[model samples]
Target: MRQETDPRDGDIIEYLDKGRLRLAVILAEDGNKKRYRAVSEDSRELVLTLRQVTHALPKQLSPTLSHEQLGQELKSIRLRAEQLVVNVDASDLWELLVGEMEEVELSTLADLAHGEVSAVTCLSTASLLRDDTIYFKHRKDSLYEPRNHEQVEALKAELAVQERRTQSREVFLETLVKALDSTPDERGTEFDKVMTDPLLRRYMEMLLHLAVAGENATDTGEACELLEDLQARLDHRLKGHASRKAFHLLVELGHFSPDENLFLLRHQLPAEFDDVLEEAAAALVAEGPRRLREALELGARRDLTSLNLFSIDDLETQDVDDALSITRIPWGWELGVHIADPCFHIAFDSPLELEARRRGATLYLPDRRIPMFPVSLSEGLFSLQVGELRPALSFLFEFDDNLNVGASSIVQSLVRVSHKLDYEGVEDRMEHGSSALDDDLRKIYEVADLLAHQRMADGAVSIDIPECKVRVDDDGRIWVRQRRRDAVSRMMVSELMVLANACAADFCVEHHLPAPFRTQEEPDPPMDERDFEHIPEGLALAFALRRCMPPAITSTHAGPHFSLGLPAYTQATSPIRRYQDLLTHFLLHGFLREGRVTIDGESAHLALSQADAAMQSIRNVERDSGRYWMLRYLEETLDQVREATVVEYVEKRGDAALVVVHDTMMRVRVSLTRRVPLGEVVQVVVNQVNPRADTVAFRLAT
Candidate 1:
C-alpha cells in the first residue's frame, strides 16, 4: 500500500537519525512514491527519505524578501559593524530575516551575514555561525528558536529552572546580609539558616570565589576597596573560619597591614619547639634528676661542690649553662670552667635529644623567645643554679702566675654554684672592689686579659662591634640599648667560655671521639692593610676586617678555628641553648663513662648535618624577625630625626642613596642630593616604615 502524506514547502518536520528525532524542513515531496525531498535545519542540505516524519503543525511563513532587499539589509549590517567600536547584539536583525526565507536561501543569507559582519568586526565566520543566540536559534525546531511551536514549551521549562535558581540566590544573599547587621544571637541563627538551606549553598561557593579573586588582584587598592564594599554589603565582620581563610589569602597576596603578625602563620618559624616539644621536655625532666642522683650515689661523678663556683650572665638570664671556679695550686691557679651537663639525662636519639636536634638553637627575638628546651628543663633541672647540686662537664686549666696555661683536663663532676650574679652586679663589684668575691673576680679578669692577648698574638681577629639590644617590655613598649662591648664582666665571661670550648675541642681530638667540630679556614690572600689605613685602630678597623673574613662552618672532622686562635674548636658550653654543644657533651660524656665514643662516625655526620641545616634555618628566621621588629620600632618613632652612621653607601637610585643604619641594623634608601661617604654620621628622619616587608625609608634632615 503506497500511503501518502502531504507536506507543504517550508513545513518543519522531524526525521529519525539513529532513533532520535532530528528537525528538517520539507522542501519538496514526490506524491507517487510517498518519498520526500527534505532539508535538515541543522545541515541545510536536501535528502530523499522514506522514514516517518514527525511534526506538530505547519507554521505560517512571513512574506519572502526579494534577493535585492536581502542584499541591502546585509550591506546595512556590515556598515553598522564597521562603525561599531564594541560588540553589539544582532539578535533583532536575525529575527527580522529568519522566517521569510527557504532553507537554502536562509543558508545563503547566513553566509552573507557572517562574511559581512566578520570582515568589519574581525570575528571569524565560524564564531558567528556557532553562537546560539545569534544564528543557531533562528533555525526551525531549535530549542531556542521562537518560530518552533513544539520546542517553545521546552525553552520555557528550562528558563523557569534558571529563573528559580537566580531568585533563590538573591534571597539568600539578602537574608545573609540582613543577618550580619543584626545582633550576635540573631546573626548566628541567620547564619545557621543560610548554611542549612541546600539552594543557598551554591551562593556560598560564589562568595569564596570572589574572596580568592580579590586576593589575587594585582591592583591592591582596588581589590581592598572591593573587599571592603563586599563586607559592607554583607554587613559581616569577616571573623569566622571562612573569614580567617580569606584574611590569610589576602596575606598571601601581599595585601596585609605592616603590623600583621606573620610568625603565627604555620611554617613561618620552626615548630619543633611547640607544645609537642614540651611533652618531651616534661618526660626528660621527670626522669633526669633521679638518674643524676643515682649516678652521683654510685661514685660516677667527681664531687667539686665545695669549690666557690658561680655563674654570671644577664639580669634576666635563667639558663645558667656555664660557671667559673678557681683554686690555688703550687705551679699555677686551677681555673675550673664548669658547664651544666644536660647530656647526663638526654641520651642520643632519645625524644628530648631529638627535639633539641630539631630545634638546633634557641631563638631570641625582641618580642618573644623560642627556647631550645622547655624552661622546666633548660632553666630549672639542668641549670647550674646557686646552692643546687648539678652534674657538669668541668674543664680545669692550670694557669701560672704569668697567666700562661700549664695543662688542661676535662672531667664529669657534681658542683654547687656559690652565687648567681648578673653582669651589672659583677661590674659594680669589680669597680668598687668591696664585694666578698672581689679577689676571685679580679683574678678572673686578669686571666681573661692574658687570654685575649694570647689569642690576638695567635692571628685571631676580634670585632668589637657593640650590639644593639632591642627589647619589648611588659607594656609592649620597645627600647633599644647598646650593650657595652668592652665591659670587663662580659670579657671575663666570653674569654672563659672560649677557653672552655678550645679545651673541649683538644680533648675530643686527643681521645679520637666522633664530635662535630667548628672550623674556620684562613682567609685567602689575606685582607689588604691599605683598606684600614685611614681608619683608626678601633671599631672601624674591626668592621672593615670583618667584611673580609669568611664564615665559620661545622664538620665531623676537627680543624683549626682561625678567628678563635684555636688548633681545634667545639662548642661545649651553653648546651641548654645549642644542639651542637649538647652533641659535643654527649660525645665527651659517653667517652668518659664507657671508655670509648658511643656514636659512630656515620651517625655523628648525619646528626651534624641535620643540626647544621636546622641552625641555618633558625638563623634566617632570627634575622628576618629581627628586621621585622626593628621596622615596627621605627614605625613608633617615625618622622623623628635620629643620628645614624652610614655603614655603606650602596647604589644611587635616582636621587636616593641606599645606606645601612648602624644603630638599628636596618638598611634604608635615603633621599640625598649629594654623595655620602662611608662611616659618615648623618641625621636622618625616618619617612616610612613597612614591617610586613621589613623595610624602612629615610630622608636627610634639613
Candidate 2:
C-alpha cells in the first residue's frame, strides 16, 4: 500500500470517465469532504467531482494561485495558444507506448500544463493512491508502491535505446533501396562491402522469401507491389550470381514470359527443338560409320534404274522425297512414283526411329530449317539427286486412257533420277513444249489434269491460300515474297501426290493392313451454292472455305477425307520430313518384303497418340516464329498504306476484322467501327507493331 499525494489549487489532473482521459485543473478543494472543484483544461468550465484522478504531470509545481487569478491567466493563455489535448487513458496512448502508433512526447503535455510541472510529468494514477502518497503498479495486476526517481530514470533509458535502434534500421532500409536501383556493374565498392554484412544478407534473404510467398496472394495489388519493389532492387546489368538469381526470381513471379524477356534483352532465343538434333546425333555416333556403310550397300534393293525417273521441286528444296516416271504400256500408261527409302535405312524401334517419332515433322522457319533427320541423309545419300542410284519404295500404277487405275503395286526398288527440274522450269516446258523431254512432261501433265478434274467432280475441296516467304538480307533487313499459288506446276505436283496417296490407301484397305490414315469428317453444307460463287477468287475463297471445314487429323482406322475427295487416304510422301509418312513407308515396305504388314492396330494407335504432342509443338513453333518475323517486317515498313481485303469478321474478338494485305500476303487484325462484309477491299495504314509480343495493329486509311 502507498499514500496518495494531495493536489493543491491550480494543479492539473486526468479525470477517467469510461476509460477516457480529460485533463482538469483544481481551482479549489474542500478539506472536510476530500473533494475538489476543478475546471477542465479543454472547456475551462468548473465542475465538482469525487472520481479518481491520474497524475500525468511532473513532480515540481508552481505555488498555488488564487482562484480569481488562475481563471484570468487561463483565459489569456487559451486566447494565445493552440489546444493539443492528449487523452492518456485511451487505447491510443497504449499504442504509442508500444511503438504501434505515431510517436508522442511527454514534453508536449508539459507545455500544455502552463508551468504546473507536477500536473503533466507525474506517472502515478489516483486510483492507486492510499493515505497521502501516490503509487504505481510495476507489474500489471499487482499491488502498488510509492514510485521512486531511480525507476523512472531506468525506464526512460530503455525507451531511448529502442528509439535509436528504430532510426538505425530505417537508415539501412533506405540504403538498400538505393543499391537495388543501380546496375550490378555500376554499384561501387562501398555498396559491395555493405552487402557483405551478415545482417544485410539475412534481411535480403527474408525479403526474397516474402516475395515468393506473395505469388499466390489473394490481393493482386499487394502481389504486384511486392514484385515491383523486388524488381527495383535488381541490378540492371545482372553481372553477379546473386543478380542473376534475382532475375530468375522476377521471371518466376510472372512479370513477363521467357520468350518476351529474351527478345527484349536481345538474347538468343531458346533452341528447345534442338534436343531432337542432339538425340539424333548421339544415335548416329553410337551406330558409327560401319552401320551407315551397311545401309548404303543396298543388298535388298530392286533394280529399276532403267526407268527415266525425274523429280520436280522448288529451286531451294533439298529433301527430294518423290520422283515421277511414266512408260507407255499396251492399255494406256504405267505411272511410277518413287519415294526415298529412309524406312529401309532406319529400322523400326531403332534409336533414329524413336528420335524421328519424337519429332513428328521437320519445323520450317523463316531464318532456318530444322530437319527431322541429319542433312547427310535427308539432303545427301538418301536424297533423290540427279543420276544418283538410291533405294526407293516405288508405287507403280497401270492407268487406262481415262486416267482410271486398273492395278497398283508397291515395291522396294533402286531408281536413278534422270533429271531434277524446278517448278518454274517444268511450267515453262509444259506450256511451250521446249524441253528435250517434252513428250514425257506433256504426258505427265495430261494425266495430272485428268486426275485433278475427276477428284473435283468427286467433291474434292481445294483451298489455295498463299503464304509469304520471309528473307533476311546481309544487312539484317527483312523482305517478304508472296509465294505463287495455284500455278500449273504446283497443281501438277499436288495432283500426282494425291493420286499416289489414294492408291497407297486403297492398297492398305484391300490388304487389311494396320496403318495411320489422314481423315476429315464431312463439314456442314453451305447455306447456298451461290454463297461460294459470290466470294472473290484466290485467298478470299480459300479463307471462306477454311472457316467452314474441320481440321484434318490422323487415326488408326481409315475414313473418308472430304477435303481431298478420297474415300481412304494415307500420306506416303516426304518420308524424310514427316514421321507419319515414314511410318507409312515402313508398313508398305514390310508388306512388299514379307507379303504382310508387321505393324498391328495397337502399334498404329500408339504412334498416332505419340505424334499428337510433337505435331502440336511443331505447329506452335512454326506459327509463332512466322508471326514474329512478319511483325518484324511491319516494323521496317511503318506508316505505309497497303491495300487489303476483309477476309472475315471475327465476332469473338470484339470489333475486329481479319484482313489480308494483297502485296505482302500478311494477315492482320483491323479495328472496325462497323461490320465489314467479306471480300471487301480496303486501304489500311500500319499503326503499330511489336515483334516480341507478335502483335500488329492497322488503322483504316481515310
My TM-score estimates for the predictions, one after another, are 0.68, 0.63
Give the alpha-carbon lDDT of every model.
Answer: 0.69, 0.66
* Best candidate, lDDT: 1
Q: Give the Å error, residue 257, model 2.
A: 16
Q: Per-residue lDDT for 1-702 in model 2, tens only?
A: 111566666665556656665555676676667677776644455554554664424422232654455555444443333222332332222322333223333333233333333332232222212211211223211123324446545755776776765564445455555645555544444345445765444444443443333333233443244335544555433322333334354344333233332321221223343566556655554553454345447556667888998899988898899999988899999988888988656778777677778878776777667677776667866688898767788888888987787888788887889989898898888888765476788888888888888889999887788767776655666778776657888787888898888888988888877777999988877435687886777667788888889888887689999989999999988888988888888788888888886888788778767866787777776776777777788887887889998887778556689899986777788877677667888899888887754567888987
The sequence of per-residue lDDT tens digits that candidate 1 reaches over residues 111-204 is 4544342323322221243343323353332222323334445655777888898788668657756764577567666756766888776555
The alpha-carbon deviation from the true structure for residue 22 of candidate 2, after best TM-score superposition, in angstroms, is 25
Model 1 spans with C-alpha error above 4 angstroms: 1-260, 264-280, 287-289, 537-539, 651-662, 667-677
- lDDT of candidate model 2 versus the reference: 0.66
